[model samples]
Target chain A: MLYLQVLINGILLGGLYSCIAVGFSLVWGVLNIINIMHGSLIILGAYAAYFAFTLLGINPFVFVPIAGVALFVLGYALQAGVINRVMGAPVLITLTLTFGLNLILENAMIFAFKADYRKVIIDPPLGLIEIGSAFVPRDRLYAMLLALLLVGGLYAVLRTTRIGRAIVAVRMDREAAALMGVNVPRIYAITFGLGALMAGSAGSLMSVIFPISPLTSVAFLGKAFVICVLGGLGSIPGVMVGGIALGVLESFGSLWLGPDYSTTIAFVLLLALLMFRPTGIMGKRGFE
Target chain B: MTGGRLLMAVAAAAMVGALPFMADNYILRIATSMLMYATLAMSWNFIGGFAGYPSFATAAFFGLGAYAGAVLQTKGVPMIAAWIVAGMIVTVFAAAVGRAILHLRGHYFAIASLVIADVLREVINGMTNLTGGGMGLNLPVLKIDVTTQAQFFYCAMLAVALLALATSVILDRSRVGFGLRCIEQNEDAALRLGIHTSRYKTIAFSLSSVYPALAGAVYASWVSYIDPAEAFDVLFSIKPIIMALLGGAGTIVGPVVGAFIFQVMEELVWRNFLNVHLGLLGLIVVLLILFLPKGLLGIGLLSPRGRPLTAKAP
Candidate 1:
């Protein structure tokens, strides 16, 4: 029964984890920038949702798209205005640039929000549902479903839409895509914006389950790294698999090793994956 | 080295050596910090600047050194011996880890290195008996007066910085240094040229690790307290990279010059904009990378074709 419960919990958590990594994976895959500001962007989304819920009396789930759109604009502006200037520089330069952006965003949040943890508390607590000796919280279940839906929508957009094909085209070969009349810089901006949108929505969903603070951005970023490495970089389905795997593993790890060791386990797993299979479970060779 | 350059070096060393005698405690402390950062920046130059590895493991090596020194001091080891032993321990550890991860290039290598400090922090936290977990640990306080102690640490840090500078000078002239530069330019070509890329990279990585370890040890002893959080602060890994980049990476004097300039800027920004210092630092980094990729030293030192004189044409 306990094992069943843990498995369920892990799967649910994995859904959220997938949501977190999906945006990061896309930007990294397409832009070839690690987007160190990703976690902070997610936090910004969470704050947007938190403020909306508190000030506007709106549910966080309802405010998810609003947060996503807001972040999309910010991400698009950042990539277009700032990051695109260094698009031709070394990987380290871009990474450092994003790191700087993260510092600015995180510190701004800290200055504005005073570093306090904020959460959107529902007026009536959403209770839990039991299935064959395991109980799952309603909020987590909704969060998971919403995450899956968003990921599915994104996957569909990539598969069917013109812009999606352009992103894919750009990712496969930038010069070729540019030669084919695709606006490479614009695609990069759109990809970054999409990534931020996903992060913002994930942040909105995460606020329901976890406390939102600027400090947790690093942890979120770390998890995204682990998941991306685990499932493979730049692959949507791979992120899903990786997220669930990490979720399940963390669930079991925390159960056995105590909660404090969960982070250590994740990092150890990341190092091992990086060493043994830098390509990740589903990643092809060149992505590494 | 030219006689003029050697003489300038000596004069600079003498000036730094005389700082403790001439400056107040606050200025002496800042000088000590500048030296520590100089050591860190120079150390980072070996792997990051010369070898082009973009390692973020500075905090890992530093925290390991601090804890190793602190734990040994608690066990009644003499302070200097502890610092030396800690350096050796971190050097060996870095060499091993470098061998394991150096094959990864670009972002993969960066992420792998970044995670090291986090893992070390967790490990240190778990070892409650030795590291006191998250509660922090205290080193034995020196019996000397405050001023003397500050001077002692200042001189100690200056020695480490000088050692790093000397090593950088030697590396710039050595075959191994040439090999590292080749590897940085193109690893595949360097490897094909029979330059033992792995060995050179590992050597660079270990070289980068040692001075930061020594600096960490000296820092642990100076502060008289060490915590896993403070020891493994990611800023320790980041600030040195910024310093190196702010001067001019891959040059002998770049990291040291950058460290001094960055320290002064940091002190100024921290004083005036305490609340937004981090944001300001970030702004500086963004602006620096965007507008001055060649660094402050590259200003007016361009070649006829406008490339930085020190940089090889890509």
Candidate 2:
């Protein structure tokens, strides 16, 4: 029964993990650049949700799309105006640029919203649903469901839509896509927007379940990097698999090794995986 | 070398060397920390700037050195011996790990290094008997107070920084430096031209780790306390990279210049700006990234366009 509970918890946690990973992975897939400030951006989304709840009195669920859309536009402009200029520069330049952006965003958030932690007062119905011999909280179950839906929706959009094809095309061959008359820059911007939007949605969901703070992004950034590496940079479905594996590992690792090691496990796993298997699960080999 | 330039450098070093004697305790303290940071940044440039492999595990190596020193102190070793042993240990670990993980490229190597840092910290935390778990460890003073210790650490750090600069300048003109540049530009071509890319990178990686380890040892000794968080702080990893980038990576003076400028800026912000300092720092990085991707000393300022700047001392 304990094992069952662990599995269910892991699966649920994995859903949220997938949400975080997919956003980061999408950005990596499309732009060939690691968005170092991604975690900070997610925290920004969480803060947005907090404001929506406290000031505007809107439901946290209702604020998801609103925050997502706003972040999308912001990400679009960032890529279009700034990142595009140094698209093909050395990787060090990209690293320095994004790293600087991360510092700026993190510090900006800290200044704008003080270091105090905030959480949305959901006041949810504290009911538990019995599944076989295990019980699950309604809140967690809802969060898990929403995360799954978002991942599925994102996967579908990428797999089935015309814009999605363009994105995949660009990722595969930027020059070829441009030669094929695709507006590569526009597609790149949209992909970045979508990636940031997914992160915003993850943030909104996370605010309801976890305490929100500007610093929370730093922790999640570490987690997201682990997941993206595990799942492979461009492989969307691999994120789901990676997330589930990490969530389970973390849950069990925390149970056995204490919570102190729980957070670091993901990073350790990430390094091990990267050293051994940079391609990640079900992903194309090399550079991604 | 021209006597004028040599004299100028010596004078500058002497002025900085005399700072602890002349300045207030606070200035001395911050200067000590700045030198530590400068050492770290310069060390990191050995790999990230020169060899083109940005290892985010720099904090891990630093933390390892700190812990090694701290652990040796518990075994009743003197601080200086502890620091030397710590540096050796970190050097070996970096060399071994670099040999294995340095095979990866770009972001792959980056994420791997980050993982190493996190993992090392966790592993250290798990050894509760040794590391004191999350509570951290405090060292018993054999015979030292905070101020004098800070002075000692400052001088040690300054010495290490000087060594790093010397090494960088040496490598800047050596055959290995040429090979590294070739590899950075085109690994395939470099390999085709008979460059031992892996060996060169490994040397750079081990060399890069030496100063951080030394700095970490001094920092732990001066503070007389160490913790997993303080030791493995990712912020340390990021700061050096930022400093290297800000001043210009691959240049001998870049990390030093970057560290000095950024540290002073950081001190000023922390002192006067209050809560908005983080925002300001972020803005600075973003602006730098957008405007000066080649770093503080770009082609336009330092050298003619499309010309390789590769001359050593006359």
Candidate 3:
């Protein structure tokens, strides 16, 4: 029963984890740059929802697309204006640029939000869902469902949309994509925008569940990095599988090793996986 | 070395040496931090600037040294002996870690290093009795007058900074620097040429560990307190990288100049805008990384284009 409960909880947590990982993985795989600002962007999305909810009285979940669109514009502008210039530089250079951007974004958020931990309480909590052998919170169940919807929607768009075809083509071969009349830079910008859209929506979902501060991005960024690596950099479905595995593993790790070791468990797993299997679950080898 | 440049070096050293005697405690304290930062930036240049490896392990080594010094001091060991032991321990540890992670390239190597810092901090935190966990540990304060105490640390750190500069200069002029440059340009070609790339990198890595470890030990002793957060702060890992980049990564004098300039800039921003100084710092790093990748020395120098100003220091 304990194992069963753990499995259920892990699966639930994994859903949200997949949401965080997929956007980061998409940006990394397509842009071929590690987006260190991913966590900050996620936080940006959360703050957007906070403002909309508090000031405009919009429902947090209803603010999802609004936040996503806002961040998409921001991400698109950043890539077009700055990251595009460093496209040909080494991976380290782009990564550091993103880190610089992260510092900027984080400090801005701290200035506006004042480093206080806040949560969007839906004003009287939602009831829990009782399964055959375990209980799950309503907010988490909603988060899981929304996560799947976004991931599935993203997968479908990439498979069917024309712009998505360009993104895929550019990801596979930038030079080839350019030679074939695809505007590689535009595609790159759009991909980053799409990534931010996903991250922002994920942030909205998270704000409803977790008490968030600007500082939480560091912790979340670490988690997202681990999950993205575990799932594979380019493979979209890899995130779901990787997220579930990490969630379950972390759950069990917490159960046995105490809570203090849970964070270490994620990083240890990341290192071990990077060393032994650089190609995660369904990922192509060598940072693909 | 050219006679003119040699005289300038002597003059600069004399000025720095005389600072503690003439300057007030505030000046001495700030200068001490400047020297410490300069040493750190120079050390980072060993692996980051020369080898072209993006290592984020600075905080890991520093935290290890700080804790090592603190623990040793608690056991009644002499401060200088503990600092030396800390450096030695850190050197061995860095070599082992470099051997393990140097094979991974790009983000793979970077993320691996990032994880190592976190792991080291956690390991230290878990050993509550040794590290005192979140509560932190205090060192034995030097039994001297406050001004003398400030001067003591000032001189000690200045020595480390000078040593780091000498090492950087020596490496820049030596075949080891050429080998590292070759590795940076093309690792595979360097390997094929029998340059023993890994050994050079590990040696550089270990050598780089010494200054940060020593600085961490001195910082712990001078401040009379040690904690995981302060010791293993991730900002420490990147600040030196920024400083080195701001000056000139591979140049002997770049990081020192970068450190001094960045320290002054940071002090100004921090004093005026306490709430958003970090944002300002971030803006500077971004601007520098984007606009001045070659650092202050990299722009068209009087000597020539593509040559850092310090190229003809001798």
Every candidate's DockQ is 0.63, 0.53, 0.50
Give the clash count for model 2.
5
Q: Candidate 1 lDDT, tens digit per residue, A1-288?
A: 999999999999999999999999999888888999999989999998999888898899998999999999999999999999888677778888999988899899999998888888997989999999999999999999999899888999888898999999988888889999999999999999999999999999998999999999999999999999999987888999999999999999999989988999999999999999998999862222
By summed lDDT, which 10 consecutive residues of candidate 1 chain B come out lowest?
A: B302-311
lDDT of each: 0.90, 0.81, 0.84
List clashing residue pairs in candidate 2.
A103-B282, A104-B282, A107-B278, A107-B279, A108-B279
What is candidate 2's lDDT per residue for A1-288, written digit by digit as tens?
988898888888888899987888888777878888789888988999999999989977788889899899988998898787777666666766787777778777877888898888776565889999999987778878888898899888888898988888888888898999999889988988898898888898888888988877878888888888787777878888888888989988887887777877777677678778888787773212
lDDT, candidate 3, at A230: 90
lDDT of 3 by residue, A214-286 (tens): 9899888898889888987788788888887888888888888987898899998898888888878788732
After aligning candidate 1 to the native by TM-score, how far in Å is the CA of A203 from where it should be? 0.8
In angstroms, give how far residue B269 of model 2 lies from its true place. 4.4
What interface RMSD does candidate 1 have? Answer: 2.5
* Model 2 misplaced regions, further than 4 Å: A124-126, A285-288, B1-4, B142-150, B299-314
Point to the candidate with the largest TM-score.
Answer: 1
Top candidate on DockQ is 1
Q: lDDT per residue, candidate 1, B89-126, as tens digits?
A: 99999999998999999899999999999999999998
